[model samples]
Target: MVRGDPIDRRLRTLVLLGLLLGLAGCAGGAHRLPYDSWRLGLFAPNYMEVWIETADAVDVQDRVFRRAMNGVAAINTPKNLKGDPRGWPTRSGAGAGKQVLGADLPRLVYVRWQSLAEPQTYEAYIVIPEATRRAMVKPETGYCPARGIWREDYRDMLTVGLAPGGIARVWLMGGCLSAIDVVRVQGTVVKKGPYGGKSGGQHRPLSATSKAYIEKYGIPYGSW
Candidate 1:
């Protein structure tokens, strides 16, 4: 059997060890990162009812549309928004109002909604800011490694707020219902004038919580 010099053998062993260490570092880095799929919640905070025609997640890398939501419509009715005593929009426990959106960060979200009262349809292809995506996967504030990680408490849910005049806002619902505004995407009207039935009813007054929200963060286009 042929054998290399002792120094040559040691150098080859070191190179192989270096490669293994590099691969291990990469694997560890990826393991610490969060997954691509996350839960999503939709809300209609406007007094007038809003019908969601489509809410899709677009993988811009592949240019494919993923139907993240199906058979669900958001309307700001008293009963629909009743679960949360704080008056913030909550899931109605019916239909797929809350679903999983699978896509990488900074993906495009295309939403289409119909203002039932105005009978106008609005649509927009919104993009989530890259910074916001990074924040979403960050470790919890005051985290302690000794306590271990609670995978479920990773704050992996995002809420989309819909209002009249095609004003759309995205919020990251952190632990303990702490919502942080991520981005605002303005939509353009696609169709106008009574596309279907008449107005559901007269516009109701904004809920107290909604009033506070608007006072802090005004709705787009001066829409209620």
Candidate 2:
């Protein structure tokens, strides 16, 4: 029990670390990370995160950012209708932004998107346990059976499961940035606004219009 004993010092360090973890685990009450905002707003336990970028470039226009979106969006669109949707750099702005699923998700896979300064937009579908998915997709929430061109809003969440596990995809309207971070789902959102306006139940139905849009433009990447 000596104050400066090796065992005593080790115990003290462990206690300090535990306290720091507790501070970080504000929501779930469990020791966890995501202490910084760079994580993808998934500050909880038992979650998995995957990340892919726009393949970085000297010229933002040269980046395969839209193709990255098209690569995944191809799952639903018609085979013949070619090309990933294009973007307008003047419209969406050149700043960074973050978005979140306001409600705890009920689906096995939840979508997260982040805009970056590396001339990239980050998006990922973090898969959860089936049981958790089932519990989260409440009747009122209408999270399963993902739908058409509508996206990044609460109402479209009903249509989020459009392609089984691949439903949660992100679309960027376009712009360019200078510097940024990886933004994994485990981070929290500090600065928030209408990264894209909330859908507020005003969603586009899975109509021919939407199908045509997807076929011609990919999954609602830029504007119509």
Candidate 3:
């Protein structure tokens, strides 16, 4: 009986030590930061003060285009964006573009073009750190803006990049939008695939249904 008592005490001490060690291991790994896969710092970002001026020839069509572009940029900045599992980013917003900046913690930066000028254009500068530049590759070719001639089509096709990283991506999409647009924002770390993939430039022609909505509601979407 006496010998058994000593052995039991030693066993209890060992069990307690093991539990403490396991907890310490978990604590150490919990706060570790995620590592980005792309090579950084290859693209030389020029130091240009943000400036944009539209020619006098620009028209109302150009002004409307500028307003939509601003709306898209606003949507991408904060909680309106998400990363696609297939490597592309998607907007989490309800109607138009998603806001994704704060949620994803991506290192990419987006800035709206400095002015509300005609021939409306916005610029995004992708930055790569000095380390990742070697392996970094440019985005795929399919990601271009669609030039929609119709008003409804123009609004739907307008989009901006959200939570961008070493690679910059902008996408345009159009469809039927309800009055109570519900925007859902989510985030995932993208480690591989094309920088910007899919029908980025794919423009959606204004459907008969959307035209009816516009006729009834007269620009259901609010002003920029």
User: Best by lDDT, which number?
Assistant: 1
Kindly list the per-residue Cα lDDT of model 3 for residues 49-137, writing each as its tens digit.
11211100101111101111222122211112121112322332222332221111112222333211111223332221212211112
TM of each candidate vs. truth: 0.56, 0.18, 0.19
Residues 19-103 of candidate 2: C-alpha lDDT, one tens digit per residue: 3433212223321212211111211000111122211100101111121111111122233444333321222221222322122
**Candidate 1: global Cα-lDDT?**
0.51
Top TM-score prediction, candidate number:
1
Error of 1 at 162 (Å): 1.3
- Model 3 compared with the native: what TM-score? 0.19
Poorly placed runs, candidate 3 (over 4 Å)? 1-122, 125-155, 164-167, 177-224
lDDT (10s digit) by residue, model 1, range 1-224: 11112223313333343334332222212323375466566766544446676666533232333346633355443534333222335432222254444444334566776655343677766666555666667756533244664434445566677667777777775443346667787888764322222444333234465455445544444642
Alpha carbon RMSD to native, model 2: 19.9
Listed per model in order, the count of residue pairs whose N, CA or C atoms clash below 3 Å is 0, 15, 15
Ranking of models by lDDT: 1, 2, 3
Q: What's the CA RMSD for each of the models?
A: 16.4, 19.9, 24.9
State residue 133's C-alpha deviation in candidate 1, in Å. Answer: 0.9
How does residue 168 of candidate 1 score in lDDT?
75
Candidate number with the higher lDDT (1 or 2): 1
Model with the higher lDDT, candidate 1 or 3? 1
lDDT agreement of model 2 with the native: 0.23
